[model samples]
Target: MIVVLIGYMASGKSTLGRILAKKLNYDFLDLDDYIEEKEQLLVSDIFKSKGEIYFRKVETLYLKMLLENNTKLVLSLGGGTPCYSDNMNFIRNTVKAKSIYLKASIPTLVSRLKTEKSKRPLIAHLETDELLTEFIGKHLFERSQFYNLSEVTITTDNKTEEAIIEELVLKLF
Candidate 1:
């Protein structure tokens, strides 16, 4: 079975994926990191040099390849993975993949993202707190429908990584 964790940036997908994979004794694949390795470039670089359209094409290719090589694995997908192209539908239909959405409040997301802005590509240029909050709110609202399609939705507000993982494990099995 494949476990795909999807959420907005700073929603703890990678961290929770790692913990969940460990708990299940399955391998873990971070979709962004996998893309970076395959493309031999940082995701930020891809966005800067070729633009989002090109990068998402590459993302789709890599996503398909990963699914082909499937074993029992936990995958942490990018924030926009499900929102773009046919990626969400592909995941839903491909394997015994169970989708999990990590839901975080706007304020919680803003606080978490502020410190790690340098790492994420899409929201890196968002400077002011007000602007960042508003931007995230708009994006989150727009993407909520795709996110709500997940088989399990877990709220991550004010929860430690371990607690979230525990909740996810229970919900998943």
Candidate 2:
């Protein structure tokens, strides 16, 4: 089985994916990191040099490639991966692939992202917690529709990583 983790930035997709992979003895592949390794460039660099349209195209391509080739794997996707293209539909329809949405409250997302904004290109330019909160609220509202389409929806708000993982394990099995 393939486990795909989808959520907004700082929603713990990568971290949970790593832990879940270790627990399940599955290969862990972060889609952004995979793209970076394959393209020999940072996602930020891809956005800066080639623009979002190009980046989205490559992202979709790699997503399809990985879904086609991998099994017994844990895949953590970029926050916007599902919102663009028909990626969410593809993920949902793909056999043996399970997509789990890590649903976080806007406040939870804002609190986590405020400190780590520099590491995330999309939210890096957002200054001040208020601005970040506002942006997350609106962005999350827009993205939630796509996110809610996942096979499983796990709320991460106020939950420890271990707790979240535990719940996910119960759900998956």
Candidate 3:
């Protein structure tokens, strides 16, 4: 089975995916990291040098490649991965692939993303928590439609990683 973890930034997709993959004894692959390794450039660099259109095209290409080629895998996707191209549709239709949305409340996301702004290119420009909160609110609102298409939706607000993983395991099995 291919377990695909989807959610907004700082919503614990990568962190939980690593742990979930271990528990399930599945191989783990983070799509952004995979892209970086394959392209020999950072995602941020890709966005800066080639622009978003080019990045999205390659992103879709790799997503298809990974989904088609892997099994017994836990794939962690970028926050925006599903929103662009027919990526979500492809995941939904893929056999043996289960898409899970790690939903986190706006406040939860704001708090988590506060300290990690520098690491995230998308939210790095906001100068204040209020701005960050507002940005996340609007961005998540826009993205939630795509996210809600997941086979399973796990709300991670105020939940420990262990608890979230426990719930995920139960739901997936």
Q: Which candidate is the best by lDDT?
A: 3
Whole-model Cα lDDT of every candidate shown, in order: 0.90, 0.94, 0.95
Candidate 1 has its poorest 10 consecutive residues by lDDT at: 115-124
For residues 68-161, write the lDDT of model 2, one tens digit per residue. 9989999999999999999999999899899999998988888888888888878889989999999999999999999999999999998888
TM-score, cand. 1: 0.95
**How far does residue 116 in candidate 2 sit from its true spot (Å)?**
1.1
Show where candidate 3 strays beyond 4 Å.
none
Q: Kindly provide the TM-score of model 3 when superposed on the true structure, using C-alpha atoms.
A: 0.98
User: How much lDDT does candidate 3 score?
Assistant: 0.95
Ranking by lDDT: 3, 2, 1
Best by TM-score: 3
Q: Clashing residue pairs, candidate 3?
A: none
By summed lDDT, the worst window of 10 consecutive residues in model 2 runs over 115-124
